[model samples]
Target: MWQFFHKLGSPKWFYGIATRFMPWLLASGLLLLVAGIVWGLAFAPKDYLQGNSYRIIFIHVPAAFLAQSIYIMMAFSAVVTLVWRMKLADVFVKAVAPVGLVFTFLSLFTGAVWGKPTWGTWWVWDARLTSMLILLFLYGGVIALDRAINDEKSAARAVAVLVLVGVVNIPIIKYSVDWWNTLHQPATFKLTEKPSMAVEMWVPLVLAILGLYLLFGWLACLRMKTEILIREQRTRWVRDLVLAGGK
Candidate 1:
């Protein structure tokens, strides 16, 4: 187990692994996403209360879940980078920041769109919403800070600290609806209990969530491979890879 963990820090090893699985992840993710969206939008039972407007949840919920999940992944990478000083860990952080940012923005935008019909407003200062906005800023900060610093090692350390600090907001976002009288509703899905909605309503959501997670995995792997190439350009493997036309 320790040997496997140590191998994970090797850029060459990780690059090879990522290359092998990236295509599979992309294909599976897209397949699931399309199946889920089509099923939910075209066939699933419409909400008796919100009607078709609630269809946005198919997109919104998945994006929101992935946005938070990506940040939590980054937080773990931050720890790995800081403790083990693993180059690949920092590489993961840099590669995924923009992806996280995109998903976070998607969640917020879809929330606003969903909110207009539900809450009668496009935006609100609700706790969950506010913390999610803060999470977006945190992602931007990570990316900005990484680019701002001239030294790669220093930048990794700095970003790691910032990520650890920002992690406090995650719990706040998760429990905000329960802790406060917010307009945002409670989670539609929970691991501990059965889903509240019918099988037809939730089955597609499960597929969507799984699809989005796989898509994020594909994106992260793609970016990490590119980052590995850039960082390892002077190394023999990268040189050989380039000479072989990036095969």
Candidate 2:
């Protein structure tokens, strides 16, 4: 296990592995996403209460879940980079930041759209919503800090520290609906309790979540490959690869 972990820190190894996996990832991600969209948008029953507006949850919940999940992943990568000085870990941090931010923004946008019909207000200062907004800011901060720094290593360290510190917001975001009397509904899918949703309703939601996760993985790998190419442009193999591609 330790050997596997240490080996993963190597850029050449990770790059090779990532390249090998890219096709499968892309194919699977697209397949799942299409399936989810069809199931959610076409077959799923409309909400008895919110009617068609509730359909937005297919996109909204998955995005919201990914928003928080990717941040935690970024923070974990930060810890790995800081403790082990793994260049691949730094690459992961850089690769995931923009994706995380986009997902966070999607979540917020969908939430507001859903709010208009449900809450009769498009915006609110609710705890869950506010914390999620802050999460978006944190992702932006990481991306900006990384770009602003001149030295790559220095930038990685700085962003890593910021990510580690900002992680405290995650749990706050997770439990905010329960912690305070907020307009936001409590978690819909729970492991502890049987899902409150009917099978028709919940199946599509599950598929959407799985599809979003696969999409995130696919995008992350693409971004990481780009970063690797940029950083390794001067290397013999990279130069050879480019020259070969041009032939």
Candidate 3:
């Protein structure tokens, strides 16, 4: 297990592995997303309470899940970078941030849209809602901090520290609805308990969530590959790749 982890520390090895994995991830992710969306939109039964408006949850919940999952992943990577000084960990943190930001933004936007119909307002300061908003800002801040520093190693170190600190908000965002009185509803799915949703309703949601996670995996690979090429442009492997492409 430790050996496998150690192997992942090598940029060239990971880049080569990621190159092999990217096509499968991308192809399956796109197909699953298309199928999930079409199934949810066309076949899933309407919410008796929220009606068609609830359909937005198909997009919203998955985005929210990814928003939080990506943060935790970054925080873990930060720990790896800080303790082990792994360059690949920094690369993962940098590559994962923008995708997390987009998903966080999507979650907030979809929540607002979902809220307007349910709560008769576009915005609110309820605990869960406010915490999710803060999560978005945290993601944005990490990305900004990374780009703001001119020195790559310094920027990565700085971002890693910030990520470790900001990780506290992830659980806050997650449990806010449970811990406080809020307009936002409790989670539809849970790890320990049976899902509150019916089989038909949740099946597509499961697909959406899986598809989004795979999509993020695919995006992360693309971003990591781009970052690797940029950082390793003068390295032998990169030069060989370019030469191979030209042949």
Candidate 4:
């Protein structure tokens, strides 16, 4: 296990391994996303209350899920950096921050779009929405901090501390609906309880979530590989790989 963990910290090893999986991840993710969009938009029954506008959840839910999930992943990477002093850990944080930021923005944007019809307003300061907005700012903070420091080690340590502190906001966002009366509805999907939605309504959502998760992995790997190349540019192995690939 230690050996495996150590290998994961090796940028060269991960880069080589990741290159082999990209094609499969890309193909599967794209296919699942297309299938989910089609099923949710065209075939799923219209909501009795909100009608077709609710279909936006198919996209919003997945993006929101990804937005939240990627932060937890980043937090874990931060821990790895602090405990194990793994260089790859910070690379993961660096590569993932921008992608996570985009997803966070997408979730907020889609939520507002979904809200205009359902809540009769385009914006609100509800707990969940507000917490998510803060989450986006956290991502931006990490990115800004990373860019501000010249020394990579110093920058990484600072970002890791910031990420660790921001993790407290995640559970607040998750449970905000329960903790306070709010315009945003409670979770439609729950682990401890049967989903509030019918099977037809939920199946496509599951697909969208799965597809988005897979795509996130692919995107993270793509970005990490680029970082590896940039960080390892002066190394002989990177030069050799480039030369070999050029032949």
Q: Say which candidate scores most in lDDT.
A: 1
**Model 3 worst lDDT window (10 residues):** 238-247
Full candidate order by TM-score, most accurate first = 1, 4, 3, 2
Query: What local lDDT does model 2 show for residue 139?
Result: 94
Estimated TM-score for each candidate: 0.99, 0.96, 0.97, 0.98
Q: What TM-score would you give candidate 1 relative to the actual structure?
A: 0.99
Model 4: per-residue Cα lDDT over 1-247, one tens digit each? 9999989989888998888888788889988888888999999999999989999999999998998999999999999999888999999999999999999999999999999999999899989999999999999999999999999999999999999999999999999999988899889897688899989989998888888888988999999999888898999999999989921
228, model 3: CA deviation in Å? Answer: 0.6
lDDT of 2 by residue, 1-247 (tens): 9999988987667777877887787788777777877888888988899899988988999999999999989988999999989888999999999999999999999999999999999989999999999999999999999999999999999999999999999999999998999999999988788998899988878887888898788788889889988898889877876787821
Worst 10 residues of 2 by lDDT: 238-247
Q: Model 1, poorest ten-residue lDDT window?
A: 238-247
RMSD of each: 0.7, 1.6, 1.3, 1.2
> Positional deviation of 121 in candidate 1, in angstroms?
0.5
**Runs with alpha carbons beyond 4 Å of true place in candidate 4:** none
Candidate 3 global TM-score: 0.97
Write model 3 residue lDDT over 107-178, tens digit each, in one string. Answer: 989989988988899998999888888888888999899999999989988999999999989888888988
lDDT of each: 0.94, 0.90, 0.89, 0.92
Top model by TM-score, which number? 1
Clashing pairs in 1: none
* Model 1: lDDT of residue 73: 93
How many clashes show up in model 4?
A: 0
